[model samples]
Target: MLKKIDQAALFLEKNQQVFRCPFCHEAMKAKDKTLFCSNRHRFDLSKKGTLYFLKQHVKTEYDQKMFQHRRALILNGMYDPLIALLAEKCQGERVLDVGCGEGSFLHLLEQQATLLPSVGFDLSKEGVYLASDYNQKHFFCVADLTNLPFNKGTFSTILNIFSPSNYQEFARVSQSNGQVIKVVPRSGYLKELRQAFFPEDLAKQHYSNEAVIAKFQETFPKMERKIVTYTFEIPENCQHSLLEMSPLEWSVTKERKEFLQKNLLSRITIDLEVLIGRFSADNMKNM
Candidate 1:
């Protein structure tokens, strides 16, 4: 039996810290089942226990179907080692995931340790809804990374795994002593998918390792990078889901899909680069 989160009560309890009115940057405080700002701005919490405070809306590429596919793949332990490595890196005071699709990583973290406090935000409403259903204790919201409705210096640790990066916004919301753990896909990731999709050209696209180093070096004085690679079998039934989980689905035509299904590959490579950066006052000054 899963506990249903009362969005209103949860919002009231955590709204002040979790949300800030984008209009005035005033903390939203719950009063009489409504969230209000000091400047008299008010927003209602949804019946389902979530709030929509996005300044603007943008269509997300990852949708319900994509998340469903990802959920299946993740549940099969495709990225277990990466999750474990991240769990080891996190000190877990106040963790925020920028693009937490369906709350898989957050759920994994919950299983691994008693974290301090965790919150996940994503552009997809469907993803947030699904995440909330998965765990009531962990807060999940539909929000954008480009313009997060959070006060500066809020999060202790930020996680951006295989998602877009808004480093400027991330820096603004992160505490001076906070750290960011970002995971980027290496060239070898999903090599089999590429092989199945484009058998003729198997040339691996080289990753820009120097570009990653240079970008983080501009942000943090102390940064560390680690490479993690593993192999996972994608069952025949799960192959369609895995195909749908990636952009390759679009790139690979129906003929290709049918061809791959006929001669389906059983396993694929999973390679990722994890970058951890610690922010300092000096680093802020440099920026």
Candidate 2:
């Protein structure tokens, strides 16, 4: 088997045109195990076959343990229905997952549908590191969403699922015929969990995607919107993982956490809206 660095080197060499230097905005080329721009700003793949586009270490609330829980939930098929919906909307040969936490969604999407050259990047080093353990057919990197390391018109399908987005950067890196599939949580998403933990907190109990939806609609006026809502029964093994997987658990009180951990939730509401649209650089410029 090829060494991890060798695998990443091969990918970078084959797809060098997809990238530009995050710092100087110059085109970059892969040389053996390293990627370097014309100005000699270089990045190397880690031993685990992942690359780093981040200039400095970024501290995020998402740690390795949380990613582990998230990955467990994914592998256990918690997101299969949502993944199927995403697969149907996917088009073109290249897919880029923005804010790809743990890389499970991208990895599973390819598994459930046609194989494509997929790339996933996240701000969390732990998330990217865990992602590299997925199929070698996909590439994972630690990158900033505000300053993506990809060149213009690189990806045909861009996925921003339950994560943050940079619309300007998304428009810049998207192909003319490309589509962006963004999934935002609905008010009912994880309603049970929220109520169990923060019953008195109305703001925490309800979520509105109106502002986010409005912004997306403004950016892509003729976008298609689909609401996918379902309740997934939590398996006995995944109950604890479900509790700890989301950022919601981070702020819960100690008593609530302990109670939820022991009592466990039977199911979770998966309510999300998948917005699909062809990005117009002009529209984004106007915004």
CA-lDDT, candidates in order: 0.76, 0.87
- Write model 2 residue lDDT over 1-287, tens digit each, in one string: 87767778788888888889999999999887888999999988899888888878889999999999999889987888899988777734589998898999988888767756779999999999999887677799999999999999898888999888788888888888578899999999989999998978988998798999998888788999998999899888989998889899888999988988888998999998999988665774653
lDDT of 2 at 59: 95
Worst 10 residues of 2 by lDDT: 278-287
For model 1, the superposed segments whose C-alpha errors exceed 4 Å read 1-8, 201-210, 235-237
Q: Per the 3 Å backbone cut-off, how many clashing residue pairs does candidate 2 have?
A: 0
Q: Which stretches of candidate 2 lie above 4 Å from their native place? A: 281-287
| Highest lDDT against the true fold, candidate | 2
Candidate 2 lDDT (Cα, 0 to 1): 0.87
- In the range 66-119, model 1's lDDT, one tens digit per residue, is 888888888778889998888887745678888898888888877776676678
Top TM-score prediction, candidate number: 2
> TM-score for each prediction?
0.89, 0.96
